[model samples]
Target: MSSAGRALAVPAASDIVDAELVNGDETAASGVDVRTARDRHLSAETVAAIEASAAASTRRAYAADREAYLAWCRQEDRTVVPASAETMAEWVRHLTVTPRPRTDRPAGPLTIERAMSAVTTWHLEQGHAKPNMRGARAVLNAYKDRLAEQKDEAARARQATAALPAQIRAMLAGTNRTTLAGRRNAALVLLGFATAARVSELVSLDLADVTGAEHGYDVTLYRKKVRKHTTNAILYGTDPATCPVRALRTYLTALAEAGRHDGPLFVRVDRWDRLAPSLTRHGRTIGDPAGRITAEAAAEVIGRLADAAGLTGDWSGHSLRRGFATAARAAGHDPLEIARTGGWADGSRVLARYMEDVDRVKNSPLVGIGL
Candidate 1:
């Protein structure tokens, strides 16, 4: 077998039998089972470490993609471990042409792209040659090009309307501050808007990450690129009703009442309105006592609050981040300043693209011209 093909092979019973024979004398002398020792040597520590390279959410996504690919391999009686270029090309074609189960619609270009990435990563990690297929790339490119001809479907699907300043105020008003869940939700929304924080950053926050400041609060955020903590100042808004600092303070008071001193700043709440009890006291609790909320749940929180406020549109975790950028630009804040507040690295095009629509409207040549 070729070296690449050999790397993909799982251990067979014959190989194990040979190993047992080789170590049989040692096993007899030591009064220990050689097979057991060999199994210990072949533990999954390496696999665990490789999987740990990705964040939890990314790992989950990759796992699902890998499972799907394996299932396809099982159905086709193909080797997934050392998946050949032809096999990969066929998989891509299958993804693009096959109607999804229980639906007539084929997989979208982006979905296929992500699935391909997952497959590629799986191969590399499993000690197999990367799936190299110009044919697959060409096919996917053409498919994407065809989709691009359709304006609505081709445009970025996540390009939903941003929640502006008034819309955010309405969302805040919709929540009742008296209840624990309400207080947490209100603080979560206001803080997210004020900081323009990604859902991951928002959920990863710990009590120690925050400190009281003269005007508002200073939050220490962990920058993944730098692998260090950088502090951002969240200033208090003028209005008490909409002030993020005030809302945060109220939530902190509730936290104190619950006898929580450390751990995740934002925890989960059950459907019955029961709060995820604090893990500070090491007491048993219903639901996850780990305190930190998942990024997906964080997105749902924003959507649910937005729905309650009578806003009409698809809202996701990206909404808060996008809303902050758009709202900041509309309020006449300098683009560079807004970018800095949102943690955009200098000279990055992300901030520019985000503010492009806002700039087009504000700097339009037809603004003062009569119809």
Candidate 2:
């Protein structure tokens, strides 16, 4: 996870932190001392709570960003902490102008901005003033314009290639249905596309979230947006080969027979074709059943399936979401209905953007005309 084209140069805690974050410089730099900062000693539970404030992903990025900043400051012979607005501006300018030392590729606008955000986060966390970002943002906007003028791929708005119904079937064909991983992946793909779920929602789906419904299964997304416990139906498709309903049952039935009827619907599968059991943070095994698959792993599953199926185009986790909207629109499903099924807000610009790509050709005024 390099935000920039080049790696962030983030080291492990063993590489960065010493015994304490704020030690006996007599709390000289910041008023707060590490040991006496709070009324109670900072318990592991309290530390976990504080870190949980940001998403796991965000916190990771912040860590990398902080390291990147430190590395950059060391290279440039500048002050590290309590970075000034001028330093930020200088960094962005350097990122914009210089080719990556190793790869010789310039960092994209988005990457530069993210790196800046990571640095700003570090400053604020240490009780320092947030670096004014106006200069850095201006640099970024200029960089974006330069990339657009040069027709760089990074300049274009990112969109995943839609995995339409036929393509979805092709991807399913790539999986070895006999294995636990294969069946689980098939269920993951079908449920993803059928419900237009983001990978995050798909992984959060516990067994309890899925209930039997008329003609299909109704699933409630654990992480809701706009609405709480938002439920959607997975209807039976005409083809048993590609039907989401059958895929889910087939997959779950295997799990049930294995005596796994609880916890995460999706879990890690080892190379041995064994379902991975949930584990504690200490690397200790928790019990039977399994842990939720990571969003990254889910994306890899989609990508691997797409490649195996020989379906051409950029396919990732988001392809399921983008594909669902486009496929439903192609079928003449009402826009509001499509939004409802996907848990998108009615009239969402993001959803509209997904459909609009295909619609440019599909919905052209000249499309059905004699042309």
Candidate 3:
């Protein structure tokens, strides 16, 4: 026979049997079984292939939403399996009527739409030939129109009670400077207003981030969430005329006079000025001597200061940022300039939200008509 034909040919019964089996012995000539070792670890190439098949952020969001829906299904005594379009449509309807947790809010059109998108993504990721989310999509669209109307009504309500910039300034003027804590609180409020920083970013500041320069002190912001896309910059030219930064410098100098260093700039000081790490989420002590501050701590500082200053009207960490934008625009500063200082790419939307028509009324000549 040809060599190729011999290679293709199946072995006879005598040749197919192992020599060890024929001899009634336990071990082969090589004393190792290849099949046993192959079952243990996967090859490096196979591991890399599995890692490459992992889902992106959007897909993960969809999966989370789908899991929420499935949990709801079990609670409602509905079939957990989503095999047909009818079940999907029913789930969409349930989402619209369902009451959300911890609030008086109902699951409106927007919520239903997000749920539908998530469920559809889940089916596609599982390699299904055809997803049955068409009915869910139709229900979502109907709910979305209703949600838009509700949003418009809520926006109109907000326009009626918009706080004036002068009111915020008057509130800041009331902070006491007698005690160390009072002075620190005053400085924090001023810094937040001047920098227009998010509460989280403001509280994360360290002593190393601020330094004295020839003109004035420079404030260095590091890895701030707002400046995530851009390189961190130093804010120079800070003085008393600048408001908050000046107040912060005064507080820092006071700390320096006491020989305090090698710790966070904003430490948790009690009534006696003794420092402690701020309490963490699980009530454990955060012992990082120069560690970052939590967003919750920043919010508490704002609330406490507002109470001490006798300021009213839904104040939170966001109040400082919003107040800064309003105050800057009122002082005739350009929107783009304010945005750049606040770490926003553009300030057009912020200006539109906070700037009233009364502020721009001088551009028209009709105000001088009675002359």
Candidate 4:
């Protein structure tokens, strides 16, 4: 938006607290007291940092949960904020019984947990007393048990299929390398797989984050789920056609030629084969993100490439991460080595899950036994 247009646009949901403060309001504009927001004496930069602390998707989920809870409270003529333990327990029950919009099924346990967390976050933000959730969790457990009895699909865990190095090569082979989009995808896939970086981390990379190293490029992942730690991992170059470093060099050269020497490492390509327009965190044409691709869009790039390669299974951006672990394990790398590349906590159950069954057939004890 232009200067005047920007000046006139309403504050977003996130900025409501700050807006009220800026207007010299003693109270909040939102119905909730927002005591926590009120109590904060942070600078605009600090507030912006706080707003950016959570991932965009996470913030959106919390907001949606708060809205749903607020709507239910208003509809049932119950208190909104500072909810009682009974109220919370009843709320979970309501979520379990109510059919999710369009879907006939009620909210699953994970959804219920997230919803509860949303309400908790809202209450905490307002400095309200934490509503005891023991009763609520008990109810959620019962719901899970019921689902387990029925063997509901919602009860089963879903995992992304791993796209091993060979599959990744296939994806690159099928991609139209003559185009900007293809080059970008090639770089994204290679770097993500090589480092076992999450889609979020992959998109979080800025041009400055990557630096040339002896064998490959050393990638500094500044933005991550665990804010306290920033990881530096190498993206080794090999096999000229599918080399992550080579692909990145080609992509970065193209990006530089387009006058994009800085900003996000990966960005959108317009249908016209040009760099996409700058986008804000909320996808407005202005603000922080100067054309960085969202996690969802990046995932689609992987899926689309996978489809072009005629590879099947539940491929996604996560496939790269999973593939890294599997591939590393197959190559006889230790868990510590794999963990270092991917930032998985030592002994993380989820990481262990990915490595499970990977060597079952290949390294079976019975393989060399005589029949």
Per residue, candidate 2 scores C-alpha lDDT tens digits across 65-114 of: 67767888999998887777788888888888878766688777767777
CA lDDT of each candidate? 0.76, 0.80, 0.59, 0.80
For candidate 2, what is the lDDT? 0.80
Q: Candidate 4: misplaced stretches above 4 Å?
A: 1-48, 228-241, 256-263, 276-291, 345-349, 357-371
Across 1-371, the per-residue lDDT of candidate 3 in tens digits comes to 22112222323233445553556445565544544644544555555444334334444655577788788778777664444687787788777766778555656554556667766644443334335778877876666666676774322223212223454455556655555565666666666666677666677677877766654556655424343522233343234433555567767766666566745666666667644445566877555544444667767777765666666667677777777777777778877777766776453555457555435664467777897
Clashing pairs in 2: none
lDDT of 2 at 55: 62
> TM-score for model 2?
0.74
TM-score of each candidate structure, all chains considered together: 0.74, 0.74, 0.60, 0.74
Better of 1 and 2 by lDDT: 2
Q: Between 2 and 3, whose TM-score is larger? A: 2
Q: Using TM-score, rank the candidates from best to worst.
A: 4, 2, 1, 3
Give each model's clash number. Answer: 0, 0, 1, 0
